[model samples]
Target: MIAKRLVIAGVGIAAVLGGTAVVLDQVTAGQSADSRSAPVAGSSPTASGSGADPGTADAATAAEAGGAATAEATGAAAKPAEGSASAPAGREVLPAVSPSPSGLPMPPPPAPLISLPLPATASAQGKIVDGFPADVIAFPEGTVVVSTGVSSAEGSLQISADAIAASSQASVVGHFQQILGPLKFWSEPVQAAEGQQSMRFSRGNDSVTLTTSTTGTGSTRFMLLANLHAAAGG
Candidate 1:
C-alpha cells in the first residue's frame, strides 16, 4: 500500500511542474511581443506609436512652403518695379521745360551792313562831280560839297559825293525820299550806326545810299553814293 501512495505523489508533482513550464513559456512570448512594439532609443514617437502621423507631416510641409513663399515675396518687394526709373540719393532734380508762347509776333531780324571802298579823287568844297546824276538824285539843299567823284566804266556809272548841310539828319534823309518817291524808288533794308541815320533807294538796276550823322557844330554831315546803269542817266 505504501508503494502505491508514493507513485501517486510522483505523478502529481510531474503534472504541476509541466503546468508551470507552460505558464513561463506564455509569459516569455508576451514580453517579446511588447518589446517588439515599443519604440527604439533616440527615435521619435507618433500618435499611433507605430509610425509617423500623416496630418503632422503635411502641416510641416505646408509651413515650409509658406515660409519660402513669404521670403520670395519679401525679396521681390525690395526690388524696383518695371518701367520705373529712380535717381540717386542726395542728387538734384532738374526742372521741366515749358514751351514757348504761340500768340505773340516776333520782331524781324536786323538787316546786314553794306561796306564801300573810298575813292582816290581830290574834290572842291562846292562843285559837283562831272558825271553826277543831278536830275535823278538831287543832293540836300544848301549842301556844301566836300568831295565828289564819278566813275563810268563796265556799262555802269557810280557817283559818290560827301557834303555838309546846316540841317538835321531827318531833313537830309527826307529831302531825298520826297524827291525819289515820285520816281518809283523803293527803300531797301539798312542798318544805321549809333547816333546816325541811313537810307537806300533802289529802282531798275539803280541804287542810292545816303548816310547822315550829327557833327559837333550841330550840323549834319552826309555821304551819298549812286550806282546807275550807264545808259539811264548822266
Candidate 2:
C-alpha cells in the first residue's frame, strides 16, 4: 500500500508542473505579441504598470527614462549661468557724464588807468582854480586842469590856465570857437603849424589868448591867458 500512494503522489506532482509550464509559455507568448504590436498602436507604453505585458512595461519604462532625459537637457539649455551676461532688449545704455567744476575762484580786477600831465601842481592837478571865469570859458568834458593862476593888477583881472584834454587839436579849437562866438568876441585868424595852434579873441575890454598843441598820444595840451577889465559904471 505504501508503494501505491507514492505512485499517485508522483502523478499529481507531474500534472501540477505541466500546468505551471503551460501558464509560463502563455505569458511569454502574450509578451512577445505585445512587443510586436506596441510600436503600431503607439499607446500601450504609456498605460498603467499593473496589468501591462513585461515587454510593454519595459518599453514604457525606457520611454519615460528617455523623456526625462530630454526634459533635463532642455532645462539645462534654457537656464543661464551664474554670472553670464543677459541679452539686451530695447535702447542701448551709455556711460554717465560728470559735470564740470563751477566753484573756482576768479582773478582780481585790473587797476584803473590814469594819464597825468607833467608839471602838474598839487593844488590844481585835476580841479579848476578859484576866481577863474568858469561860465565864459567852458572846459571840455573830462579836461584835466594841470595849472591855474588868478591875479589882479591895475584894477584888471588876469587869469592863466594850463590843462590837458583827451581830444584832438581841431576839436578843442572848435569848442572854444563855439563858446566865444555867441558872446560877440571877435576872433583873430588862427595861427597853425604842425599840430600847434594859437587863437586870440577880444570883446570890449576882455581879451583871451589860447595856445594848443597835440601830444604824442593824440591828446591836446592847452594854455590860456585872459585879461578882463571891469565895465564902466554910472
* Highest-scoring model, lDDT: 1
Question: For each candidate, what is the lDDT?
Answer: 0.77, 0.75
45-107 in candidate 2: lDDT tens per residue? Answer: 445335566677778789999999999999999899889666678866666689888897965
TM-score of each: 0.45, 0.44
Q: Give the TM-score of candidate 2.
A: 0.44
What's model 1's lDDT at 209?
A: 92
Clash pairs (backbone) in predicted model 1: none
Worst ten in a row by lDDT for model 1:
110-119
Cα distance off (Å), candidate 2, residue 112: 43
Q: Which one is best on TM-score?
A: 1
lDDT of 1: 0.77
- Lowest-sum lDDT 10-residue window in model 2: 112-121
Error of 2 at 20 (Å): 99
